[model samples]
Every structure is written in structure tokens, then in C-alpha cells.
Target: MAISFDRAADFYDQTRALPPEVADQVTECILRLSRATPETTFFEPGIGTGRIALPLVERGYAYTGVDISEQMMDKLRQKLVGKPHQLTLINADITTLPLESGVFDVAIAAHILHLVADWRSALAEIQRVLKPQGVLIYFHHPGSGATRNDPIDQQWRTILERYSYQADFVGAVTEDVLGYFQAQNLAIETVSVAELPRIRTAAEALQTYCDRIYSNLWQIPEPIFTPAIEDLKTWVQQTYPDLNERFESSYEVTVTAASRAR
Candidate 1:
């Protein structure tokens, strides 16, 4: 099943706002890939809240955004007021979008591939819809490779890999991503990196942030997860409250852009 973000849509935007450093990287890559122009027809699959689409539209680019979440689309719809550019919003799956072949100049999928059951299919869809030699810009947060050291973290990774390897966030490592594009004969044009998209100064702060943000997982009725959240929080507060203010975590991200073979 595709991961659902209906209830988390508002909270996700509230916690993370536009003009954030990370967002700048994502948007900058898109612009570079599109070689931004007035006639550029851009498509953003999983365009949450129009974060990137709205800005592109405002900048005079025509855009079409598609997402599976009605709630997210509703939020994006509310934010569409006063934008005087040609923008079309669709509620559909990226893997099975109803778009004409070779229609878009550039396609973007940001921080969303990991949530799909078959990311390759989405890539195929982008290939099918983008014009020959068109660009595809994608971003991923490879959660698996990030938290592999800790036992609990490693265990979580194992479970996810076992159950959702095909769709697991970061299903493709850097090499895997590069190989996939190369095999398709798509040229890798640019690579940009950003570490720790959201930074916490100390372990305690990280714990607190994780606690508040992941309350749902912690509050689950299941015995395993129920105690894990609170225990982690208490451990952080008691053992490394000072570290919470002194430590930092950088979430490394890579933005890859490739051109479909002509």
C-alpha cells in the first residue's frame, strides 16, 4: 500500500516552510534542469502544497501537479489564490497519470519516491510523458542508509527492507540511481548535495523533536512501539540533555537530474 499522508499534510507544511535551505536546493535543481523559461511546461508529481509548483508558476512557468492525497490537494487548492499563471492540478497516481506522451519539458519528483510501491514505474511514467531529451529531476531521502548503526535503527531498516524493499525510502542508493539512469541511456547532468535538511543542536533536542513529530508511532496501541518512544525521549532528556543543545545531525541529500536519451 502507498503510504498515506492525508492527516499529516497540514502538520508537514506547518513544521517545514518554504524558502527553507533544503527547498532552495530542490527548486534550484529544477530550474537548472528546466533551464527555466517562460514556455517551460513543468510537471510535479507528489507536489505537496504546491511548494515548488506555486513558485514555478509565479515565475511564469506553466505547470501541472499531481498527487494522490485529496487532503494535500485541498491544501494546495486553497493556496492557489491570486497566482496568475497557467496551472493545472490533478488528483491521480504518478505511476498511472493520464498525460500525453512527450508533453512536459521537465518532470520533478521530490522526496516522494520512497513512498510509492514501485518507484521504477513512476520513473517509467515520467519517461513516457516527458519529451525525448526532456529532463527528470528527482530527490530522495534514503532512510535505510542513514540510521544503520544503531541496533534499533538497524532493526527498523531490516523490517522495512524485508517488507517494502521495492518501495522503501531510499530504495535506490547513489550507485543504484546512477546505474538506473545510465542503463536507460539517460545522461546524468548535475548532482547537488545538502546534508541535514533539518538540524537539531543536541541529542536531547533531536529526541524532543522526534517525540513531538512522531507521537503517532509512539501512541500506537501496540506494545512494542508504545514504550519505545517514551523510553527514547526519557533517555535523551536524562542522559544527554546538554548534548541536545550541542550536537547536530545533517540529513544528507542528493539531487540528480538526467536527460532522456534522444
Candidate 2:
């Protein structure tokens, strides 16, 4: 169950204040990951709210972004209008985009591949769209290195399924994703040596969970989302016993890069 970034648009930035230095790390890591050349025509699929895309664009990379949410795209549109960037944006699904093939130097599906349903087709399409020797950078949010059967993770899933209005938990594993790219015959490039930051304090974690409920708990009607949210809060309180303490979050992220064989 993939969730779209909608009602979350307004508070998106507020909630996502990654440490300033993290940008440098992401940029450097991506550059190292993809070996992007000056001539690289970068593609950032799922460019939500221009968080990474904007900074990458500022670095003088030619870019194209694709996204499914109109509200998110609208915000990005506003960012691109006033800035000087060598970038283009399209409102389409990455899984089935309307675009030409062999046109770009690199295609980056940043933090988005997991949310797509037909991920294999999307990857194949990405490979098709890139010229031979071009690279594909796939980024994902893993469950912070927690094993698939981690008790905490299982508990979270159970709570969400039974209590959350919509159960939208998608996990992207680094090794498996890398294997998929390899099966396509794309030359393996790099896999980050370090894991990505996944969790935050208990309060932050709780707030994030609650926020998603506001944004993605759509299985229930409007009248029910709130009640369900309250129930979740009560459950969390009873479970944690210390609602103010920062609980660890399990949101690991991974980045893999591969190049089309010549």
C-alpha cells in the first residue's frame, strides 16, 4: 500500500528538516554512486517538494523530474519557475511514463522505486530510456536494517493494519533491489558502505506516525480517520507509557547505482 504525498504538502518541509550537512552527504554520495558527468542529463523520479532535486539542480546538473501527485508537482512547479535551472518536470507515473528512450545520461529514481507497484516494469522502462552506458540510481527507504521478522516492525505493522485507516507500509531492501538491477544486465556500480538514518526520537516518531494517519489513512471515511487517529494515540500512550520520550525509528535508506552495458 503506497501512500501519495498530498495533504502532507503544506507541512512537508516542516516535518522533514534533515540536518544541513546531510545535503552535502547526499550530493557527494549520489555523485559517487552514479559517477555523474557534467553532460549527465539527470532524471529524478518522485521528486517530492523539490527537496533533493532543487539542490541537485543548483549544482548545475541537467535534470528531469516525474511525479504522480498534482499538489506536490504544483509546489515543485513554483520552485522551478523563479530559479535558473537546467531541468524539466513532468506529471506522470514513473511506472508508466510517456517519454522517449535512450535520451538521458542518467536516470535517478530517488526514494521512490518501492512505492511503485510494477517496479520491474518501471526499472525496465528506466533502462530503456537511458542510452547504452548510461546509469540508473535507485534510492529507497529501508526499515533501518531491521530484519524482515523484527518484532518491533511486526508490531508496528499489526498496529497499522488493525488500527490505521489505511495500511501503507512499503519496504525496499538494498540487496534485493541491487539484485533486480543486476538481473537486467546493468553493470553494478556502487552500494553505499554505510546505512541510512531511519528512526528519530519517540516523540518525532509518534508525530510522524500521526501525520501519516492524517495524510494516508484513506480506507476509512473522513469521519473515521480522526477516531482511528485517536485510537492510535491511545494505543501508543498505553504501549509506550512515556509518550514524551523519543523512541527509535526504523527507517533505513539505501542507494544503488548501475550502468547499462554497452
Candidate 3:
């Protein structure tokens, strides 16, 4: 079930009640890595709902963003009304971008690198449009690398490790990202890596698993998803007896910035 971020926009907007500062942090990372002078052009692939772009343009950076989902772009367009900054939003996949080469000064991919079929080709496409020394930053959040620290979370990890199926994309991490960027001849550098907070209940966390909230889980057959939940719940209750507690939700974000080789 390949998801168009447009179709997932409402679910995304509804489920996401992010900490206000998190958005600011994304903008700050871009500013720190890319020297955003007034004339410096910027591009974002899969810029769903302008999470980073909206705040970025407010600070006076020129913007060009591409996404496959028109519905998602439509939502982002509504927010750009009367804004005094340059924005060019195109409905296209980042892999086969219909843009000029060497025009952009910076390009950022937030939670998007892992979604592409051939991320190497996507990196090539991104590099095609970047000017010399252009900065490219990728934001990845490998949700809660939670191990045995919490019994219930450990169970969730256990079930996912056993059952979750992602057909094409898999295991996005900082090491793979750096290696890929280096293979593409981009100069890699670290930006900011931190764990960010969110809030969810024990039930909600389990629901995420059951409902296949994570895109990779969608590849798992419906029959398996439910049973995996049932198995996770039953075992947690029987094995970890007093382990139904809820905790503040959090995930780690690894931001790696790469420079286009001249």
C-alpha cells in the first residue's frame, strides 16, 4: 500500500499535535547548515504541508518544493496566501524532477529519504538541481529504538521485528544515509541529532501497531497485523504482569547535512 502523502495528509494533520518547538528546530537546522542569504534558492522534496518550508519562508528564504500529492500541496498552498516570500510548489516525484540543474542552493528531505523506491537515484536527482556547494540535509526518525528498557515497548519491538514487512525501503539510519551520500559524491556532515517528545497512551501505542499506522506495517497482511497485536497484548499481560503503563512518546531524529561536491 504505497501511500500518497496527500491521501495521508488529514490523518497526518489530525494525528500530529507536535510540540511547537519541534517545527522551529527543523527550521533552525536548515539555517545552520545552509547559509540562507536572500538570493539563495531552496528546495524541499516531499515537503508535506510545509512543516519546514512555512517557517523557513517566514524568515525570508526563497523556496521551491516538490511532492507527488496534489492534495498535500493544496493544503500547503492555503497557508501561503499573502506571504511575502517566493514559493514554487510543484506536483512531481523527486526522483524524476522537471526542474533546471544547478539552480538550488539547498535541498532538505524530512522523513522522506526512506520512502523512495531507489533512494540512490533520488539523491542523484536532488544533486542534479543543486548549485556548487549546495547543502542537502536529510531528517530521519527511526521510531523509538526501544529495547528492553520498558517491558511493553520491548514487546512492541519484538512483535515488529518478527512481523513488520516493508517491501522496498528498509532500516533507514544515519550510517546508511552518510554512506549513500558519500557514494553519490556529496560531502557529508552531521547537523543535529536529538530525541523529540510526543504523548501517547499504552493503548494508543498498541493501536499504532494494530492499525498499521507505520507505513511499513501496511505491507503486513491484515490477518497478521491483528494477530500480531493480539499476541503482543496477550504476552505482555501474561509475561510482564504489571506492565500496562503509559509514558510520554518520543523518537530520535538524526539530521545529516551533505554538501554537493563541486
2 or 3, which is superior by TM-score? 3
**What TM-score does candidate 2 get on C-alpha atoms?**
0.78
Worst 10 residues of 2 by lDDT: 143-152
> How do the residues 41-158 of candidate 1 rate in per-residue lDDT, one tens digit apiece?
8988888787767667777788888888888778877876765768788888888989889998888877677666577888789888888868888765454446323333444334
What does the lDDT read for residue 206 in candidate 1? 43
Candidate 3 regions off by >4 Å?
141-154, 160-172, 235-244
Give candidate 1 misplaced runs (Cα > 4 Å). 18-22, 147-175, 193-197, 201-221, 242-246
What is the overall TM-score of model 1 with all chains considered together? Answer: 0.79
* Residue pair clashes in candidate 1: 196-250, 196-251, 201-247, 202-243, 202-244, 203-244, 204-244
How far is each candidate from the true structure, as Cα RMSD in Å? 4.4, 4.0, 3.3
- The most accurate candidate by lDDT is 3
Q: Is candidate 1 or candidate 3 better by TM-score?
A: 3
Ranked by TM-score from best down, the candidates are 3, 1, 2
Poorly placed runs, candidate 2 (over 4 Å): 1-3, 143-154, 161-176, 193-204, 213-231
